[model samples]
Target: MMNHPVSPNAPTASRAIGPTEFRAAMGQFASGLTVVASLDASGNPVGLACQSFSSLSLDPQLVLVCIGKGSTSWPRIARTGRFSVSILAADQQEVCAALGSRGPDKFQTIPWIATAHGTVRIDGALAAIDCRIHDIYEAGDHLVVIGKVLDLATRQDGDPLLFFRSAFAKGLAA
Candidate 1:
């Protein structure tokens, strides 16, 4: 076998990875959209749309969501130590767009109800999960927020909203 000579100017894996390239690559993976919400210091609801939620454990019932460090809602949610995850339904694209945007009074145009745990749950969601912050770890540009599930509720029937290739889609086909 012949060995290939390495060029000093050749790009390495790290050097080849840029924000746009990395985002485009990751966008290929389809993910469910969720709105993670909590009450602010003044008892007002605050939340942001997240596509990085995942179930971490079953025995103790745990879930995880990644929040950008620059997100304004994260700080308020962190301070509360409790939050709710609303799994968006197929028709809830408007809800996702609203929450994901940067502005004040995100909840103004959306319908929601507050849980006993002081977190807001979006109406007509596929499912709503209430959790208390279990752990937090720093990931490169975001924080991995692990939550201990407290209570959860599901709609009788509905299709889920999905994100793929940087756009929203209905649930996958059977």
Candidate 2:
């Protein structure tokens, strides 16, 4: 038998190596999908589909989403000072695609209700979270936006949609 060397810090053989290489690797980690939306100062709505939403802390009622620096919606969201996160249900794929597009009139095709806080909330979403901008920090090519949840509402029943490995999938029961 031949001897093999392994570094202690080396990842398990099952782990894919390198960011670019691992990007192409198989195996899907399902994420709850959402549309992060806001209305500009002029009351025009802007939003984008994001699977990066995460619960950060309970004490402060904090939530986080990673927005690409190059995203058009980020600049618009930054200006608003507040935003609404609408957790997407499985049937809301059309709403997701519409908001994810590049260009104007992204909100034209969707039905939404604006919160008193001035954030646009997409209709039929699994849940809606209204937040005020807490902190924004630079993280690689993305900005990690931290929000302080001001209000939250949820629908009693709905199957959540999921995004995994660049494809649309269904959420599993918790």
Candidates' TM-scores? 0.90, 0.85
lDDT to native, each model:
0.94, 0.88
**Number of clashes in model 1?**
0
lDDT of 1 by residue, 46-160 (tens): 9999999999999899999999999998999899999999999999999999999999899998999899998989999999999999999999989999999999999999888
Error of 1 at 65 (Å): 0.1
Q: For candidate 1, give the lDDT of residue 67.
A: 95
Q: Residue 35 lDDT in model 1? A: 98
**Against the true structure, whose TM-score is highest?**
1
Residue 163 in model 1: lDDT: 99
Alpha carbon lDDT of residue 16, candidate 2?
Answer: 45
